[model samples]
Target: MAEGGITVTIDDAEVRAGLARVLAQLGNMAPVMEDIGRTLGNLTEDAFQASGPGWAALRPVTVARRGSAAPILQVSGGLAGSITHGGDATKAWVGASKVYAAAQQFGMPQGYAGRTRRGAPIPWGDIPPRPYLPIQDGGLLPAAQSEVLAILTRALESAVG
Candidate 1:
């Protein structure tokens, strides 16, 4: 011992005992450390893409008294279709007569294009009675006046609540 009760010599038994205690503690924390490492690797800058240049820093567009006088479904042949506030967001094979006939010919169940509240279509064997879009005949499907009135009433009640 060169200083106050401090021995700098190698002690084999003490070193082994300290190593065993440290290994036991690390053994319990190995899985937790691996999970934390994986989470840190996922949120890096190169992992996900949010939007293009200058997209995040722009304010959203707002328009009052919104009205567009076109029928909701128009064939742009691409993803450029625009819809205003009152436009029908639900456009699928549900209300199409050709799709209905094809489903019948292939022995598929009727009214397969149903949705949950979040608007995902149900499969062939699993569908509710009501579809997301109600069936329309030859002309354009006009919004029912009664349904609009009911919606307005519900909105007023919700605003009061």
Candidate 2:
């Protein structure tokens, strides 16, 4: 599993309380965590399919290099296809397994000074952040948070019944 990724934790008081109740009743949260992971993975893929809905548009040079009308960050679909999710009872996660995933997600600033093995600049030009993990500003986006809350609510309902 990739270590560079978002760690989703519900901070909502009501959801937390409900999760606590469910946890007490179930004694194991593996199923819920797995469901959360799958949900996050699907959301991440949706972001990719939407060409990173909230992300910056691709530079003209980048589009020209791709040589086709391919979506941003999807030249060969390696990065997006590498996205996956897994977890145990304690936690869940979704992220790309590609080595350049971090660079694509966070972007490299201009004048990064990093060089490739062939002595070329890692980023010939500035690459704006194109977050595809359903996160924004160090937290889950509102829609993703709401979906997670819904998952927790369903779990709680199942536990109660």
Candidate 3:
């Protein structure tokens, strides 16, 4: 079973064999994965820009890497604390990189009002969910998805041809 992100499986031995040959000729899968990642990165960046002000100002980062287990596609980055709305503030979260992002995107209780050790008031307050990741109808932009599919199809055709 695939443990990480997206997974592509080919059950046909012939197709798998062809793909293996093509991969061998290509020398590595990084280039293909990178191509896909770049496309997604561009779309994500565009979405962020179109979402609104705070999101528009953010920069997106896309990374594609081949791990021992599977290939990885990571798209991240944006104005970190830009989710703070009126009467809300940012906090130092000690969890996964996306914890705060999830909170901001999915929403959390509005219960943060206090001061730091230096006595500086923390504008911590309830944050409403402001989703910016999907950037479309609960998924990647249609055009972007089509482009990615075309890329994969081309790769497969090249391998089979």
Please report the candidate that would top lDDT against the real structure. 2
The residue-level lDDT of candidate 3 at 122 comes to: 29
- Candidate 1 local distance difference test against the native: 0.25
Q: Which of the two candidates, 1 or 3, achieves a greater lDDT against the reference? A: 3
Q: Can you rank all candidates by TM-score, best first? A: 2, 3, 1
Question: How well is each residue in 18-113 modelled by candidate 1, as lDDT tens digits?
Answer: 334433444343333333223322221111122211112211221121233221122221111111112111111111223222222122333444
Model 3 vs truth, CA RMSD: 16.0
Off by over 4 Å in 1: 1-98, 101-143
Q: If the candidates were sorted by their lDDT against the true structure, best first, what order would they fall in?
A: 2, 3, 1
**Residue-wise lDDT of candidate 3 within 1-161, one digit each (tens)?**
11211221214343335435546656455655566555655554454555532421221221112222111111234333222211111111111133245544444454443222244332444445554443333444457557655665677677667
**What digit string (tens of lDDT, one per residue) describes model 2 on residues 46-140?**
98889987788777777787786567888888998899887689776788877667777888776664432354565558778888887766667
Model 3 clashes, total count: 1
Q: By TM-score, is 1 or 3 better?
A: 3
Give Cα distance to truth, residue 87, candidate 3, Å: 39
TM of each candidate vs. truth: 0.16, 0.83, 0.42
For each candidate in the order shown, give its overall lDDT on alpha carbons.
0.25, 0.76, 0.40
Error of 1 at 58 (Å): 58
**Candidate with maximal TM-score:** 2
